[model samples]
Target: MALRLAQILPPVVLLVLAIVGILLVVLPARETTKTPENMYGIVLDAGSSHTAMYIYKWPSDKQNGTGIVTQHSECKVKGRGISSYAGIRGEAAKSLEACMQEALSQIPKSRQAQTILCLGATAGMRLLDIVNSTESRRVMKEVETKLRSYPFKFKEAVILSGQAEGAYGWVTVNYLLENFVRYGFVGKWLNSGRETIGALDLGGASTQITFETAEKVEDESNLKELKLYGQTYKLYTQSFLCYGQDQFLRKLLAHLIKTQGVKSPIFHPCYPRQFNTTIKLGQDVFNSPCTKSYRPAKFDPYMNVTVVGTGDGGECLASVKKMFSFDNCTYSKCSFDGVFQPTVKGGFMAFSAFYINYNYLTRLTNISIRSSNQMANAMRLVCNMSMTEMVEKTNQMERYLKNVCAVSHFVKILLTEGYVFDEDAFPTISFQKKAGGASVGWALGYMLTMSNLVPAESLGLMKAMPSGTWTAILTLFILLLFFALGYMLLIYRARTKQDLV
Candidate 1:
């Protein structure tokens, strides 16, 4: 009876130890695995025409040292850009109130304090700074104060340089297109092997061209070197101030007034026929620094000047051509106005006013512009359309409709003539307003850069035990289970042998 009891007790104890060892290894592993919370960020794009706030989010456990950011929500500020509130002491800051409140609602209170908030003023503020440095500083200070009132981790409110703007825009384009990095089938972020494309941004007061190039950059200022996802890129970028659609139109009007001697009933070749309007000499035509060169020597600052349109598409193209200087090429190549540029390479994404103008052209002509000739045809069709016909067909406001022809010609000339996107390369330029559910702009790129400042939580710290310790313990438990089974098998074989005896 004593021998039987000893044999049964030995097997029972071994089985109990095996079960205990298994629980020790499995229970903590389950406890250690957990899904991380989502993180949020905000970027306010204070462009020339308006201010727009974009909210983005990513998993706290970032991918490959960078956050996988995606647009969560956006709010357009109610008023014009902050620069328009230059003289009004606090108005610029007040302009951001509605959008700031919207951001508050979009992100939870728990995360608001940690969420980064930044405001980057583009060409509008840059222009204001160029014109009035004191006023620009005051406006930026007011905006900074207003942002600090919120719970967010306010970073900065400053005017972005044209170079920074162009570079950030390029980053936004490539990031959204997944040219920088992409999720692989193995569930890891990997560098995308695809070639990067160029970025063409046509704002109200500035136009920028940026693209990766292997050619030597003669002008050091036009060259920008950027590193992303462990890959480095050498880019050539140029920002033309006072050459945007709005500013170019101002320059054109100022030019006509200068050449035509500021007479009432002045003829404008770009405007549709029978479209006449009265504008103040100082405010409308020569108010901008862009037209400072064309400002008349002696004229009433508020003199009313009447202008009439002839709707001559040929004349419009010819006049637009006069605005750019194709002569000077100090470098190996030049785009226009003496700016150095390497040959435009790869595909291009045109956005902002470019996309808007392209949309209008397509809607008006019902044709896709694949080449310069096709673009010229579309421009002529829209140029000849009378105000009534344009308003009826486009269902657009009169103010916006009148400038369509002039702006369209400006864009056409700016692309083919100014930037020199030839027939073969023209088709590669895609007019896009949004990509990856986010508006195609520099703001996302700015946020992606800021995300690098955020530190990622360590996986080992999140787990119940260190990975090495866990592995060692798991191995020990697995081996113990095998040893217990082996012992039980040996006892069973001995019992069978004894029964045979």
Candidate 2:
């Protein structure tokens, strides 16, 4: 009986080992450590308006997977963006002091050295570079110096490219939406188009549009290849410099300069009918790449402008439409200015200056826009309001306060004419500032890529298991081998004894 049992045990042990190994190879992964082990990361979004610091926390064991990192906290710096310090010098780095110190207080001291610190300047810096590369470098250097003072591991302080801005913003939105893992799972069973939403970022100096598509991108410059969460996507992305809200105003002002001089008060259509503000045609206006070589003879160091609003939505739309060119496209299709774009598909997420007005304009009452007409109507309502009325409604003039009407008109033209989204599709486009407690921007995407969260090659179950899980697996194998060998030896000894009998 003992001999029979021993012989049976050997085969059973071998079978158990094979099953476990196969299971390990095929099963989806879960947390390796039940006890949470946390890690920290930091990214600074230096925008045209201001700089924001994002602190993220994730279980150290699941660094490579989606939905693991969560926004721990955020600190908005107290002053203007880093680029604003270009002319004055040194203040840009000084501006980061309060925010970096706040980061020190938020993160535990032990993790400080391991935490990463990066500064990615966006359109403001990009435009700054075009205006004065020397000034741009000074600003970057000053900011870098300040970031280096912190205990966190300083990685990079550089101007981010337009392609990176668009692609990374798309990654940020999709990652928070958990589209990477969803794509990974669905890709196994379906042959279909990408389901990730597109991204549109508007800043002081530029605007970016990026999305995934099956259409061929004839302009190689406009297409970018990205691999995230174990799936590959070819994205269409473009940045229209001098097309951002601030820069667009600069262009309009430049055109206004041609028709009107500093001596005569200029009447503009975008402002309220009674709105009056003086604008200087200082070098700041014409020195821009947007105003390159288009200096009007009437230009002077100072200019006064009286903008008389024509709250007529048609006129506002028409005026905004002139900023775009519909005839220059060299591709199969164009979204103005010859830029290549797939027919706009999926819901879009816009951020920065011209962000979707979901949580914004709260003073205007709870107005949620689902169609272009709704947007147009809402903007007209606010734009037509006198400065006194508008101030009372919105509390204060945000940077774009005066040009509310033009902004709304620009949003319509940019989306409908520039991106080819119909009026009804505006409902699908959500304008938000944050996702999953983090700023809904490119900073998080920058950190994810720098951290190597996406592996170059696919692993069957979301990359390799943690070291603890690997150890448990190894121990199981050892025990199985020992049991198999011991059972075989016992069976051989029993057989010899029976033969002797």
Predicted structure with the largest lDDT when compared to the true one: 1
Model 1 lDDT at residue 433? 97
lDDT tens digits, residue span 178-216, model 2:
555532321131222348899888887788999898898
TM-score of each: 0.83, 0.79
Residues 1-501, candidate 1, lDDT per residue (tens digit)?
788778777767867876787675677445336766768999999988899999998767753455556788989998888988888888888889998999998899989988999999999889999999999999999999999999999988879989899999999998888776554422344556899999999998899999999999999999998866556789999899988778888898888888889789889998889999999988787777889999888889788988899998888878888889989789788889888988888999999899999998988888788888898888879999898898888898888888888888888888887778889889999999998777998998888777662223211111122357667866776777787778778888998999999
* Per-model CA lDDT versus the true structure: 0.83, 0.73
Instruction: Mark the regions of model 2 whose C-alpha exceeds 4 Å error after superposition.
Output: 1-35, 63-67, 182-194, 303-313, 356-367, 398-400, 456-501
